[model samples]
Target: MFGSLPLGILQLWHRKFRLLTATLGIAFAVILVFMQMELKEALYASAVRYHEALGYDLIMLSPKTPHIVAARGFPRNRLYQAQGIKGVSSVSPIYLGQAIWRHPSEPLNRRSIFVLGFDPDDRGFEKLLSPTVLQRLRLPYQVSYDRLARPEFGPIGQMIDEGMTVRNQVNDSEFTVAGLHAIGSGFAIEGSIFTSDLNFQRMFPERSASVIEFGLIHLDPGAAVEGVRREILDALPKDIRVLTRKEFAQLEIDHWSKATPTGVVFGFGVVMGLFVGAIIVYQILYSDVQDHLQEYATLLAMGYPHRYLKVIVLQEALVLAILGFLPGLVLSVELFRLTAESAHLPLEMSLNNALTVFALTLGMCVFSGLLTLRRLRSVDPAEVF
Candidate 1:
C-alpha cells in the first residue's frame, strides 16, 4: 500500500509542466472559496455590530421595522408599558437615523452616516463603549465617533486624538467629537456616530421623543428570558414585536444573508469557484490517465484489479489537494489582512473556515479523480500495443 503511494506521486511529477498548471488551477479555486466565505462573514458581522455590541436581554421593534439599517421604529410609549412586565427590571430606548456629516477639515464636503441616540443616564443600555466615554457623552452636543469607520467620514476621529477641537455638522447641526469608539462598519452604513439622546434630539428636531427605533428591556438578575419575553408579548401592543437578544441579532443577519443582493453574489461566487476547481482537476487527471493508459493496461493484463487503479488515481488527487491548499491558504491570509485594513471591514480567517476550505479542496480533487476513472476502465492491453 505504501509503495503504491509513491507510484501515484511519481506519476504526477512525471510531467512537470502539467503538474504546475494543475497546482495553479487548484490554488486559484481555493482562493476563490476563501474570499467568498470571508466576504459573507464580514457582511454578516458588520451588519450585526450594533446587535452584538449591545447587551440587552430583550429587544422591542415595530412591526414596520425591516432591519437595523432602515428600520421604522415603534412608539416610545411602549417602554412605559414594558416596565409593568413581571420580569422587566428596566427599559431604555435607542433612536436610529441617518444624517449628512460635514467633513471636519473640508467643511464643504459631506457624507451620510448612521446615527445612534441613547439616554446617557439609562444604566440598562448595553454597549461596547468605555464608561468614561459614556460619561463624556453626558456633555451636550458631544458625540463619540467610530475610529474604524471608513475614511469618507473625514478626520474627526484622528483630529480628536491629536488634541484638536474637532466638530462636524449632522444635517447642518453641529456636534463635538469628544471621544472615539470601535464598533466598526456595516454594508449599509459605513460610518456611525454615538451620542446621548439629548444631543440626538437637538440634531434632529423632526424626531420626537415619542417615537424610537429600538427599545431595550433588561431583566432582573437570574430572570427567565423566555418568561420575560412572553410577559412582554402579552403586555405590549400588537403593533410592536418583541425578540430575544439572539433573535434580534439573527434578524440583522437574515436581512443581509437572504434579503440583500450582496449575499447572493457571494454565494454564487463560491459555487462558481467550486465548479472551476472541479473542471481544472478533471482535465489534469484525464490527461494523466491518458499518459499512463499503456501502464494501466499492462497491469490489467497481469491480473491487477480495477480497484487498485482507482486507488492510484485517488492517491494522486490527495497529493494535489494537499500541495495546492497550502499555498492557497498562505495567500488568503495575507489577502484577508489587506482587505480588513483597506476596506475597514471585520474580515477574518478563523480556524473553522480554514478546515472547511481544506475539506472542500479534498472533496473537489477526489470527485475529479472519480470522473477520470471512466477513461481508466476503457484501456485494453491489446489496444495499447
Candidate 2:
C-alpha cells in the first residue's frame, strides 16, 4: 500500500496542470458546501439569540406565539402563579414588540426594530446585560441599542461608544440611548433595543403592563429543574406553554429549519455542490485511467494482481481529497470571518463543521474513483499487446 501510494501521487504530479485544475474544482465544491451549511447554522443560531441570552431555568410563552420576534402577550398573573411554586426562585415578566424606529439622523426614514422589555431588577436578563447597562435601563425612556445592529440604524451604537447622548424616536416617542449591548441582528429582524418594562408600555401605549410576552422562571439552587417545570405546567392554564431553556432554543431552531424555506434552500445547495464535485472528480479520474490504460494492461501482463491497480486509484483519490480540502478549509474560514463582520450574523466555523466537510470531500472523491474502477477492471493485457 505504501509503495503504490507514491506511484499514484507521482502520476498525478506528472500532469501538474490537470492536478491543479482537479484540486481547484474540489476546492470550489468545498467552499460552496461550507458556505451553505454555515448560513443554515447561522440562521438557527441568530433566530435563537434571544432565547439563549436570557438566564432561565424554564420559560413560559403564550401558545399562540409563533416565534420570539412575534411573541404574543399573555396575562402577567401566570408568572405570579409560577412564583408561588415550591422550587421556583422567582419569575420575571418579559415584553416583546416591534416599533418603527425613526433613524437618528434621517428623520423621514424609519425602520422596524425589536424591543425587549423587562424589569431592570429581574434576573431574566442578568446574563445578557451588564449591571451598569441594567442600571441605565431603569431610567424611564432610556433604551440600549444593539451594537451589532445594521448600519441603517444610524450610528446609535457608535455615538453611545463615543459617550455622546444619543436619543431616537420610536413610534414617535422620544427615548434616550443609555447604553449599548451586543445582541446581533437576525434574518427576520434588523435590529433590537433593550428597555425597561415601563418604557416598553410607554412606547406601545395600547399594550398593557398586565399582558406580558414571556415569563422567565429561575429555579432555586439544588432544586430539580424538571420537577419544578412539571409543577409549573400543571399549575398554569392551557394558554401558557412551559419549556426548559434547551427546549425553548430548539423550538426557535425547529421553526426556522423546518417551517421556513431557509433550511431547505441551503440544504439543496449543499447537495448540488456535492453533485458538481462528484462529476468533476469522475472526469479527472476517468481521463487519467484512460491515459494510463496501456500501462495498467502492461502491469497486468507482468502478473500484477487487479488489487494492486485498485489500491493505486484509491490512493490517488485520497491524495486529491486531502490536497483539495486544505485550501478549501482555509478559504472558508477567512470567508466566514468577512461575512460575519460585514453581515453581523453569527457565522462560526466550528470544529465539527470542518470535520464534517472534510469527511464529505473524502467520500465524494472516493466515490468518483470507485466509478472509474469499472474501466480499470476492463484493462485487458491482450488488447494492449
Query: lDDT of candidate 1 vs native?
Result: 0.87
Q: Per-candidate RMSD vs. true structure?
A: 1.6, 1.6
Q: With candidate 1 superimposed using the best TM-score fit, by how many Å does residue 23's alpha carbon deviate from the native?
A: 0.9
- Candidate 1 Cα errors over 4 Å, as ranges: 124-127
Per residue, candidate 1 scores C-alpha lDDT tens digits across 1-385 of 6679999999999999999998899999999999999999998888888887887888889877778987887789887799888888888899998988887768788888998999877864335667888898999899889898899778767787789988778886788887888887767888889899998898898888889999988899999999888888887679899898788889988878777788889989988998899899999999999989989998999999998899999999999999889889999999999999989888888999999999999999999999999998888799998
* TM-scores for every candidate against the unseen true structure: 0.96, 0.95
Best by lDDT: 2
Candidate 2 lDDT over 185-255, as tens digits, reads 88987899999999998999998889999999999999998899889889878989999989998888887
Computed on alpha carbons, the lDDT of every model, listed in order, comes to: 0.87, 0.90
What residue pairs are clashing in model 2?
A: none
Relative to the unseen true structure, what is the C-alpha lDDT of residue 134 in candidate 2, on a scale of 0 to 100?
Answer: 94
